[model samples]
Target: MAVRKKKKDRRYSKGCNNQALLPRGSKGWPMIGESFEYFGAGWKGHPEKFLHDRMSKFSSLVFRTSLMLEDVAVLCGPQGNKFLFSNEKKLMQPWLPTTIAKIFPSSQETFNSGNSKFRKLLINVLKTEALQQFVPIIGDVAQQYFESKWKGKKEIMAYELAKTFTFELACKILLNIYDPELIKYLFGPFEAIGKGFLSIPIDFPMTPYRRAINAAKFIRKELVAIAKQRKIDLNEGKATPTQDILSRFIVYRDENGEFPGEDEIADQIQGLLIGGYENMSTTCAALVQFLAELPEIYHGVYNEQTEIAKCKAPGEQLEWSDLSKMNYSWKVAREVIRLTQPSQGYRQVMTDFMYEGYSIPKGWKVYWTALSTHKNPELFPEPEKFDPSRFEGNGPEPYTFVPFGGGAHLCPGKEYARLAILVFIHHLVTKFKWEKINADERIVYNPLPHPAKGLPIRIYPHIS
Candidate 1:
């Protein structure tokens, strides 16, 4: 493998005056064997603090660590971020999918194929007409979920419930499958796939990595079957092609008059499944937790829902048009996503790069912690405080509020995720009143960051 050659005589800016230039390492190990020690456990637990400390000490940061794994460089401050994400071809690649592919080998191929097709398919299916059709479906699904799950005096884990909700919603929209048992089986494999993304590359049996590989295989098989059946139905004229995304994808032909193969279709489906659920689940749990902690925000959200309800009759469901009118609910959801970014964005440098007078070698793994950007006191005042109203007037700087990431590789399903969250909040606020069972419950940020103590909130039917 070719290593990134260090550049000579780089110029430094005033902002980076105190930055430290990274040193070179031996052929085998980078950072002279100290790479793992600094970037491993400490970085994981308190990433922001660790990065900040390094920024203050070093004029520029670089790590010559293990060549077996990519070398990681921490780019601190706003100017550093702009330079990194802007160079799309040189520094950007899907690091999360690469991590996942370590366990599920098939995932790498799936991701590569899906990236090519997602832009076309998303533009076609996520428009106003398609979203309008989905409004009723989403409303019905949410209502049914609440009725069955939150009925009676029962304590539930918010994270777990959010996971189930996301799974069901993804199934209804993506594959158009609605069978309960089938949905349960599909969700299990999908969850395993997510776990595999963060697991070590070892494929030993009983390990999370092995299970993730198996789950990927299982999901691909199911997707192939579904695609084949949909194609058959389209050919036989047994089904009318409606506005569903799957149906559109089945018939979509490219410029060369070619449709995607089974593997390609499956890959896109997998990406949608992963993108659809994980972040949304974390955001949903955080929104509920935030509402519980701040009654004023909660009441404001409730009033927004109430106003939305008043727009129609008492029993009427919300429409897409009503979404614009519910600005407060939308702001609350955006703030929650901004604050509780589920995953830190990771990108691998495809070529040797220069930023802020420092050398960032090719094949190095670069990470942007959303917490660092989102919680920056300069961008957001009183960064530790959970105030949704901060976004009420002028929101944070561009690219600063990157909970779903940014740039060309920005999540295509962002609209869908936001819609699902808003719809979920609307239901909870209008249909039920909830209070935290434990005021001091701690939120766990591991395994995709959710309420550690299950966000135990008792729900009662709202009294008009």
Candidate 2:
């Protein structure tokens, strides 16, 4: 009699709670939740498998899981992406793992109050018109980089070379830091920060998360010093207000006529540096690998770039107009990004919502992955096959190929990344022919995708 009474009470309790109707699936083990399996698939270099498995077993469009100790809804496919992206600031808001807040303490304040304003400041320099003026500067940097780093080497690690080149470009253009030694010195802690940024937020000694906190502290000190000096220079007219991003930040006054503090400026600068570093570098390394594997594609790019090269006198820098002619090259880059999508968008549910007859309670986390749409057979035929022609027409349907995400919070550096990739492609193929040293090298994601062996390749200068 007591057992029957208890069963009836349980049913009544569940009927009163909206969460009982959450999309189908398990939250996995407690404490860790599904984070192990969630990141495990990424570690195995096929992050799509996690979503693919769940989509097949449960619902294809949405499911429930837990990650980082929070109940999460994994929204799948183009429809899912459109829903989340289109509803930004309405039904959803940006969210980062708790680990980020613990490391960059200033991030929460910025995220809450100054995100839009800060993003506008960043977009000012990355917009197409602004990026147009930097084409020749990038061209010059690429030329000097190749001469110093790749001129005579018979073999080279493509990933390592790409990292250094992108880092130097970011430092010189963004921070106005030109000293090789200073850049090199800063690289170590910055790299530590990258490795620790998305790590599980455990603060124990010697852990990646702990190291990242320490590294961020060190970087904060360095940036604070830099910001303080820049502020002085700006007041004395010793530095131009538009000289670089640091100067611009120093001169910026918000609507309240207040300058952002040193800590906030440091945090934002670090974000930009890392933002421009890892993903662009990954794209560049993978671009090298794909171009080497596909000679037909290489020739297509080489032909286009050569025509542009012929139009210029010896040592002339590439103009913004030249980039427009390399459509096929850009298409190839897009396909590379599709095959190896680097980011996953995370959001927090802002209110109770109903979608596809499922209940999503407020405070639950939401994830929209590019892998689902990028690799879906229905959305992209023969998705594993590398075909640049997919982008030839009007392109993949809206939200299906979001290499840089979508909606109100689109990546601010999108145009800048495009310019950097095209400039690198021009310099790479027009100057040399290369073949992969390891034909079967595998890609692994240690929090981010990279070649298992750094992608070594044999270099042969094109016969002029």
Candidate 3:
């Protein structure tokens, strides 16, 4: 039932066949396309509605449209994930809007090998060996975060609190900057950069984009100063080359004696900071929301964490072994991620290719929605339900669940994020029992999901 056609030069030589080869669906109103509706559906809690409705209406595996003023093909289900992920850097590569590029650029272009050396060298520092030692570091950061920020609070905004904690941890783990005043100062401007990642790119004075640019400039200046100091420390034998990413960037040398220049080091670390800060914060907020709403699930997680907490004396550092025993806690975290994915993946077509017996023109954008695969009944029966047990033994089908993305583009900081979140959850569940102040709070998905009003929860500190 599939029709195939040769792709012809189409600015003029158009016909119904040209349309037929491109799949079925309106490109929507020129320029804006169906983006508003796409965002609306997500903001309204049916994030996958756009794809579902189009698949039904067009009766096709793919739907062609213009998103963000670019020709895009939104592919559906796990088959789509397989094709897009498998063909990464071969048939497709990341091609996001300029707004995203302005905030963090190298990530989308790593597929080209044009700028990969810089990124790969930087990621080399965040290897498993380095992260394996960060367990106690994150645990200690969590303990302090809870003591200073959460212990005495009657009510607090979960998103705000999580944002601070995640950002602080990122600074400590990635940059080795733990000064309280510096964290407080950087926190305010970074909010603008975070906002501008999804905002329209109008770089006028006072605009989010402009403010974000300004913030990036300031942060880059600070990073340059930090990197210079690190270089001196490395030369003086005053700092370990592997102490932090800054130090690693200072010391890393390739076989060719090439090293990341100071500017490239700043950009690379900035990308890691942007990535680690946002996803972890949103995910932590989601966990707080879920734990508040589902007491049975909370008790299950609480018991698991409390058993671990009970074994440790007050003020003792958590060992990597502690993280190993919280299997069920990890399950709950995975399910929370599935139920509320942080963002969708977008890739650009590299060469003209055939998929499922249809011609896909080169230079077009293709998107893989995580929600599409996560909610598919074929992969997860009753996908709406939050069943951590589903992940207890074997977990969901491969490529069918990609909360942290998959294939060549899997998030590099994934394990670190996992450990940080688990440690935070361990601290949270063992010490506090919380309930949402606004039980009916709704979620908004600009690029990631967070409560519309920033989830506010009343906390009851444990007295054990």
After best superposition, candidate 2 residue 342: deviation in angstroms? Answer: 2.8
- Assess every candidate by TM-score: 0.86, 0.94, 0.92
Which structure is stronger by TM-score: 1 or 2?
A: 2
lDDT tens per residue, model 3, 290-314: 9888899999999998888778888
User: Once superposed on the true structure, which residue ranges of model 1 sit more than 4 Å away at CA?
Assistant: 1-47, 59-68, 96-99, 110-114, 127-129
Instruction: Show how many residue pairs clash in every candidate, following the order shown.
Output: 11, 0, 1
Models ranked on lDDT: 2, 3, 1
Off by over 4 Å in 3: 1-20, 103-115, 118-124
How are the candidates ranked when ordered by TM-score, highest leading? 2, 3, 1
List candidate 2 segments past 4 Å from native: 1-20, 112-114
**Candidate 3 local Cα displacement, residue 356, angstroms:** 1.4
Q: What digit string (tens of lDDT, one per residue) describes model 2 on residues 1-464?
A: 44654333221113225534668888899788888998888888888888889999988999988888888899998889888778889988888778887888877766644377677888887889988767877887799988988889999999988888898888877787888899888888888888888887779999988999999889889988989988888889888887788888877889899988888888888878888888888998999999999899899989988998999999999888888998999999999899876568678888888777787878888987788888888889988889999999899988899888888778888999999999999999999999999999867776688888999999999889
With a 3 Å backbone cut-off (N, CA, C), the pairs that clash in candidate 3 are 93-348
Say which candidate scores most in TM-score. Answer: 2
Clashing pairs in 2: none
Winning model by lDDT: 2
Write the residue-wise lDDT of candidate 1 on 169-240 in tens digits. 988888777898999988998888877766656788978888888888888889888888888988899655
- What does candidate 3 score in Cα RMSD to the true structure? 4.0
Q: Candidate 2, which ten residues in sequence have the lowest lDDT sum?
A: 7-16
- Candidate 3, poorest ten consecutive residues by summed lDDT: 9-18
